[model samples]
Target chain A: MRGFLVLRVVAKLLMPFMLLFALYVQFHGDFSPGGGFQAGVIFAATVIFYALIFGLPAARQLVPEALVETMVALGVLVYAGVGVAGLLLGGNYLDYFVLAHSPVHGQERGIFWVEVGVAITVSGVMLKIFYMFAGRQRSAEDE
Target chain B: MAALTLGIALQRNLYAVVVLSGVYSFLMATALVALDAVDVAMTEASVGAGVSTVLLLGALYLCGGEEAKPLTRPWLPLVIALVIAGALVYGTLGLPAFSDPMAPIHTHVVPRYLHDALKETGVPNVVTAVLASYRGYDTLGETTVVFTAGAGVIALLRRIRRRKDGEQEAP
Candidate 1:
């Protein structure tokens, strides 16, 4: 793959656009067809493409294992924490009505944050699966 | 799509199977779009075609690319599969017709969601409102499951690295 100049150039050109589309899907989900789940997979796909073109080590270096692990936990915490916030604000568990000054605004704010959390967790899961499979091959070759 | 599935089943090469699976997923996504399930289509395209294909290819690399031969006869499994298919077809006879306005699902809670979703969630997208606010608890549970799966894979794979290092140190 390294010897293929055309492949390298095409990958370099495509990576940024792929990432941008993922972010678009993540943010525009409220108004559009995509949501956290789709956005997260798209995000992971960009990184996987990088791994395919430049090798797994390069992709791992770009997104470290520790960071990916932390993302998995942090996303869940963010989601749970939002529910707790609702409860503390004199609303039912997972209620979005009390998240802001007005009920409608609160619902909007809460849904946005929850979707963000979902996107994070989904991407982390995807990257973790990729890392496990790709790392196994590398380790086997080394042994 | 049926042709692709047949090709996948007939192919002995795991690599071809994985590739055909991706193609099947893409076709399914197109079918979902045709049914006006755009969100589901997007998910299918991404997770099924993108992530699953890469993961399968990686697995093929770690294992062998050729599928193993089955030791037993296939007739019994084929009979069981046909019976299950027949049962499923029989079961569909009891289901409401497609797009039936008076169906149980349409008459149950959908009206409220459709009428009140905008006022309730402040989100124009009813799908997102339903998924994030109406069914927040279920979404939370799904996120937890994803997190747990990731953690489980890390635990399983990282242990091998630790054990290998410990063996080297002991020697």
Candidate 2:
């Protein structure tokens, strides 16, 4: 129990920094070793650590299962919706050059939105899986 | 390396085998990354290193880690795997050299991304420009693949819980 508390405290201290780093990587992926994929993993690892130490029930209290599911769907929707937006702008699907009035700004706009989609989807999937595994053990204990 | 492979195969400890398999897959993924197959490497890191390891351990727990009987047809399987691997290596000999400057892949459609990607796309990374902008539809499909896997896992876990619940209620 004491070990678990120590882990929980450590995780609490480190999680914010990890999440900040994840965002840094996500935004700067255009010029870094980290991208949406790596940033997603790092973000997920922090949450998983929280769940492991503080218990899945507590972690779920922090980020509910329903929210995670919704985030997953929302992420994919954002991605597909961007393409549809491009199509609506009279360009080929996913042609982001015309996503805005200016081509340069439009590219940045598209990249930002798409990276957000990736981050959301990846983080949602990770949490959902962790919930599934950890939920099992929780219910077993209740029984 | 041969001895390590043999040891992993012969090990009765499933956890050790799983860890070894993870290491092996990570190495393969690294090679793919070095070969400029970032998409494949990403998939390997997520599915191979992350999900597969979790699923294998879950299975190990649920199904008791009993060692199986020794394979009687190992020789045949080995010969078949060797033959397949040989065919693959031979086929690679006719393929374009990696990063060949004059190759059609480097000269054609890909070159547009390599050249105009920075000025036009405003993105420093050509791969990102290609994946998220130039071929976003493919990425949409990939995202859907992940969503489906997530759904499948949730459904499987629910089924398992339901079965356990039924067994509990029976008493």
Candidate 3:
């Protein structure tokens, strides 16, 4: 992988835009046809692209397995945490009306945070699955 | 589309099957967009065409790239598929036409989602507003389900290898 100079250079040139597109999909989801799920897949696809062009170790160094695993849970926690926050803010469970001063703003805010959580979890899971398949037998076989 | 799908089902080469499936997914996404379901279109394109192909290739790397030869004819599967397709088409006969505004669900449930979604959630996409705010509990459950699925796979697949130097997965 390191020897594929053209691939390495092309991947380097492409990754930044991939990352930016993922972000665009994430934030514009509320207005556009995409939301967290699609955005997360795109984001994970970008990371997986990098791993394909570079080595898995390089990608793993960039995003530790530990962090990815944590992200898998943290997303759910964040989603549920928002619901709890709604409750603590004097509304029912998962209520967005109490999340901010105005109910509309609260709804928007809640959706935003929830989308973020979803994005994090989905991307993490996708990467973890890729890593699990690529890592274990791979390293042993490589050496 | 049928040609691509037939190529996928009939191809003995696992790599060609994967590639054909990717093309099938892209076509499916285009069809979804034509149906005015852009959200679903995006998901189908990204998840189906992109990552899953790579994942399948990775799996092929471990196992042999060739699919195993079947000992018998695949007639039973063909019959089953035809039966299921017949049943599905029969079922669809009773349903409203595609994108029919007068359809039951459209008349019953979708109006409010389309009308009040923006005013209620300040989100322009009715689908997002419905998923995130109106059906918030379901979305939360969906997220939890995704997390649980990931955890389940990790539990099943993660092997603690005993290296010579006592190396380990990071905590």
Candidates in order, interface RMSD in Å? 0.8, 2.6, 1.2
lDDT of 1 by residue, B84-167 (tens): 999999999999999999999999999999999998888888999999999999999999999999999888888877888787
What TM-score would candidate 1 get against the native?
Answer: 0.95
Task: Give the Cα error of residue B161 in candidate 3, in Å.
Answer: 5.6
Best by DockQ, which number? 1
Give the winner by TM-score: 2 or 3: 3
Per-model TM-score on C-alpha atoms: 0.95, 0.84, 0.93
Quote the lDDT for B154 in model 2.
84
Best by lDDT: 1
DockQ of each: 0.87, 0.54, 0.75
- Classified by CAPRI criteria, candidate 1 counts as high
Ranking by DockQ: 1, 3, 2
**Model 3, position A51: C-alpha lDDT score:** 88
Better of 1 and 3 by lDDT: 1
| Candidates in descending lDDT order | 1, 3, 2
DockQ of 2: 0.54
Q: In candidate 2, what are the lDDT values of residues B100-134, reduced to their tens digit?
A: 78988777798789888888878888777777777
lDDT of all predictions: 0.92, 0.77, 0.89
Instruction: Flag the better candidate by lDDT, 1 or 2.
Output: 1
